[model samples]
Target: MFCPKCKSEYIEGYTHCKKCDVDLVDELPEEPDEYEDAPSIDPVKIRYAPNAIDAEMAMDLLRQNNIPCFSKHSESGGYMSIYMGFSVYGEDIYVDRNNAQAALDVLNDWDIVQGALGEDPDELEEPDSPEAPDEPDESYDNAPSYTRRRTAARVFAVYFAASIILASLFGALIMLLDILLD
Candidate 1:
């Protein structure tokens, strides 16, 4: 006897495969080759998310619509997430080229539905280009990057300070308990 699921051969008396929990058959069907009849899956980027949460949400949406998708974190994103709580560089979501259009459609539909529910679609639309200033503004040029760097530094500082304070408190508590017990 043979188990179709696990492809395990058994004695004639054995009626099922214990591991696969499938009924045994007299003969097993021929297994197809790994690449046989399989469509070539070339991943195409569908969306760029600012963080892991957005990337996960997009991936989940695609999966619900039966589209297979995956995420690629930027080099900095992966490392930054380990140090920080989340990535700052963001992630790129990809889907098979064959399903790219369908995946986009699904995402677009989701966006429209979400907009209808509460969000303003017009506010969601990004401006084509910023209005040019008559005179160059040095402060404006560095504003965004400066703000991001300052914010990140502040966050790191706060985390480091909090950890140190907590550790000190914990150590003090432990010493107090030891003295009391002694």
Candidate 2:
């Protein structure tokens, strides 16, 4: 079955979600009496106490373990808004009341493993140290600089004069060609 939160798949008999820590069982107490003499106990719904992700993960785990599980959202919107906005309010996972405790135990085991690891799986790694500041180059700063305004103007003038001369030469050649043709 796929994890409702992370969408990760699990095999049958899986108790806890490997990717997310969520209980896959229902843990509510059984009804006090089937007969009229005893007061009836309300069925316990499997719910994620904290986040929708957790609830979805728990449902996925339950499905993998061959337990059918479903999400009960008070609001009709998607899971994110239901849990994130507190639209669902109380429990996030609703399982058969009978399976609640077993699911919780599975989740607890996963939590223990996470605690032993001493770090969150989702946490980003920090750099070992801040980057060193770039050093200023004194040699370049001390280098001599030249103004190119005069040089550029001189180059432009030379190019203009050459173009004029070339144009005149071309015109002369064309005139000669016309005379010869005539």
Residue-by-residue lDDT tens digits, candidate 1, 11-73? 878998999988999998877898888877887777767679978988998898899989988
C-alpha lDDT score of every prediction, in listed order: 0.76, 0.53
- Residue 116 lDDT in candidate 1: 94
Give TM per candidate.
Answer: 0.53, 0.32
The list of candidate 1 runs beyond 4 A from truth reads 1-39, 123-143, 146-182
Give me the displacement of residue 85 in model 1, in angstroms.
2.5
**Alpha carbon RMSD to native, model 1:** 7.6
lDDT of 2 by residue, 1-182 (tens): 54555555666777677668864443333446657686443344544344467666666777777665566653333443533354333234554556656655555566567667885745421211112232433654555432232343355557878999999999999999999999
